[model samples]
Target: MKPAAHVRKTALPGVGTRYDLNTEAGAHLSVVVHQDGRRIISFHDPEDDDACKDAAALAPAEATALSALLTPDPVAHLHQHLEIDLVTEHIPIGRRSPYAGRTLGATQARTRTGASIVAVLRRTDAFPSPTPDFRLALGDTLVVVGTREGADAVAELINGG
Candidate 1:
């Protein structure tokens, strides 16, 4: 089981408030709400409670951008999560997506499109190279592998466009 996030908010007397977050993955983030309407961010040691992990003190906008940059987008995370080969597209399974609620075998996905649905991301878990008999679900992110044209064909095949 994964550890839950631990956060603490404290009033820093005349300075302002301090918000500290201990993330599930052992990351530590601290933000100081200064009385001057500025925030001082700090990176604390995930292992050592007293020592800092790295560095940073940024304005709100800078803080946001830093956070955004640190956070990986869905596709980027998928690439990191999977053992990829050839080209791959993270195709979202929407309601109108033809593969939704359908069996992979029924779609003849491999036989027709030449794009292999090597993995499916459903919520938090990833199903890699799922069986042909496995049924696809709505909101699943299908990891397809092939050439650009083949990927496009697979997308078109599923979207019925």
Candidate 2:
């Protein structure tokens, strides 16, 4: 899982300081701050993304300003008006099935709390976008997506508790 993007620090006129970050898509970022508060952030990707450019263009003042904008409070406000869809579904597991003995199936089933199960997991493998007839086995895991509550319910059902 990728760490959420955040502002780390604002150093005073410093000796060279650097911070390393990993992006969501598995990329590395190296940022160096100079004594004068100038920053040089480099991205490891061969093809530059807009984030890299934006980071590079950020001066200390701009970085601080951007940091404020990215803060949790302000970001939360921005999302206050956005609507998120909530969906839920139950997947049946067969008795004496391959997935019946394992928690993998239960854990996967929990993921359906507020979402739809678009597939299944069977013995260390995933059935991406499984067909409706994909019979769930004792060890088979359910692939679910929905709101948090729906996912939790599915998980509980799968656990048989």
The candidate maximizing TM-score is 1
RMSD of 1: 11.9
The whole-model C-alpha lDDT of candidate 2 against the native structure comes to 0.59
How does candidate 1 score on lDDT?
0.78
Model 2 alpha-carbon miss at residue 128, Å: 1.9
The 10 consecutive residues of candidate 1 with the worst lDDT sum are 59-68
Query: In order, what is each prediction's RMSD in angstroms?
Result: 11.9, 15.7
Model 1 clashing-pair count:
0
Q: What would the per-residue lDDT of candidate 2 be over residues 52-119, giving only the tens digit for each residue?
A: 53347467645655575656663556566768755433344556344554434334543444455677
lDDT of 1 by residue, 1-161 (tens): 34555679989898999989977687888888788767787788877766876656677545655665777565765776677556778777778886788887877878898888899888668899899898988877778999788888888887766
On lDDT, the leading prediction is 1
